[model samples]
Target: MTLFFLPIPVNSPLPDLTLADILERTIELSQTAAVILKSYYRGSPAQLEVIDKAEGPVTVADKAVDRHLLDGIQAMCGDSCGYLTEETYQAGDFQLPQDWVWIIDPLDGTRDFIDKTGEYAIHIALTYQHRPVLAVVAIPESDRLYAAIAGGGTWNITADGVRTPIRVTGGKELTKLVVVASRNHRSEGLVKLLAQLPCQQQLKIGSIGCKIAAILEDRADLYVSLSGTSAPKDWDLAAPELMLIEAGGKFTRQDGSLLKYNQGDVNQWGCLIASSGEWHQQILDACLD
Candidate 1:
């Protein structure tokens, strides 16, 4: 294929692209990254080298797809916008000159990817003024894509390109809630918090994208992460957070604060909760108390 990074001259003026135009481009770029991820994923598992990072594992696919997305977005948006991805990101990379930045997790759930579970996804988001205004998540195995723009409704797109509006299930009692938790990074604090919220069932899954998609699809009512040490970074949560909120759900720190993006520090150290809007406050109170 076709690779998408073409550098523009410093004197070149930036293109005036709207949020809708960017959302379309974001979805296109995510699909490109998804194809790359699937190709590498379908290869022999023994050939995949999993290196241990400070947070978890990273594979060749991660780096390759990260490069693809970063380059593609950089070309599409030009050098005036900031860029951050899990593979190329450093401690202080967020200190860029642009007010708008692209945050990405090219291959989320590398552990599940190595295991060949097909639960991995590609995350891409555009944050304006440190808040996400557009987002896209692409699941290669399912050939499904989810996307949303601020003030626009969330949508699910099938392989055939049929799009459907998605929204969270409304107003379920705490006892009737269906909770989703991390498959690989569950913490003791999260468990104790779950104990307080009497949910109907808990579904463990890989990738923040998939878990948040569950909320958008109405498959699960809530997701909570109370990590003390291994909190999710910006790439992990930015796209998914925007999609969830656009689908009429609420996503916030466990204390009910809104999540800000593109900060100098990428670590989200506080507890995070994603829920349908109706019971968000109740769940936050239950988990925090």
Candidate 2:
């Protein structure tokens, strides 16, 4: 692993690297983490050992990749920023975060990975003052990576290192909308909400990163989550949100409230709506009213 993420002095300001420099290095770092996953991922579901957690079934790959990312970043940028990762944040005390935060979900779709569904993804976001400025979502199975930096737009990075800028399919007719949703976490309450959408189709995809990538790449038009008896944390939303937004999309509560990261509470509960930008209000009005 090249560890291109951060090789700078400690206590620095979010690395003096330009956004382009940071974005490229983060893309490289994502593939390194993906290698950790690929090494342990056998074709069979029972290949890796897993332990049940209050959150979900966490596999050894999750911890290994988390350690890889954490150790790599901390070794390079000690005290430069605070971290709020899925596997580690809940184990410790949660407090107000620093001005700079790296929100990570090492393995976002663990169930999909275990099932060999190939819909899982890795999310890494760098936030400043509680807003994401750079984001990357790497889907190793599909060989597709989505990335964005504030004011710089989003790109689809292929396995062979090709980069193509991407954006959302801005607003469509209600009946023509394609919904990108969960494959595993589908709940009855969520089903009811989906039934009301009048969308052209509902595609079951795993991981918020994947769902948002679908929107950013124009594979789908919208994704809405009602918490479904459980809510996604900051790690789940931050990166994908920035990716979609830079791609000319919007992500927020159904009531139109924007999400803030690194807050005291980790959970981002309630109706989280993500859509191609222009028609997002239609989703809110259609569902909430």
Off by over 4 Å in 1: 1-14, 92-94
Best by lDDT: 1
What C-alpha lDDT does candidate 2 achieve relative to the native structure?
0.81
- For model 1, residues 107-128, the per-residue Cα lDDT tens digits are 8888999887788889998887
Q: Rate the local accuracy (lDDT) of all candidates.
A: 0.81, 0.81
lDDT of 1: 0.81
Give the least accurate 10-residue stretch of model 2, judged by summed lDDT.
Answer: 1-10
lDDT score for residue 55 of model 1: 84
lDDT of 1 at 82: 85
Query: Candidate 1 clashing pairs?
Result: none
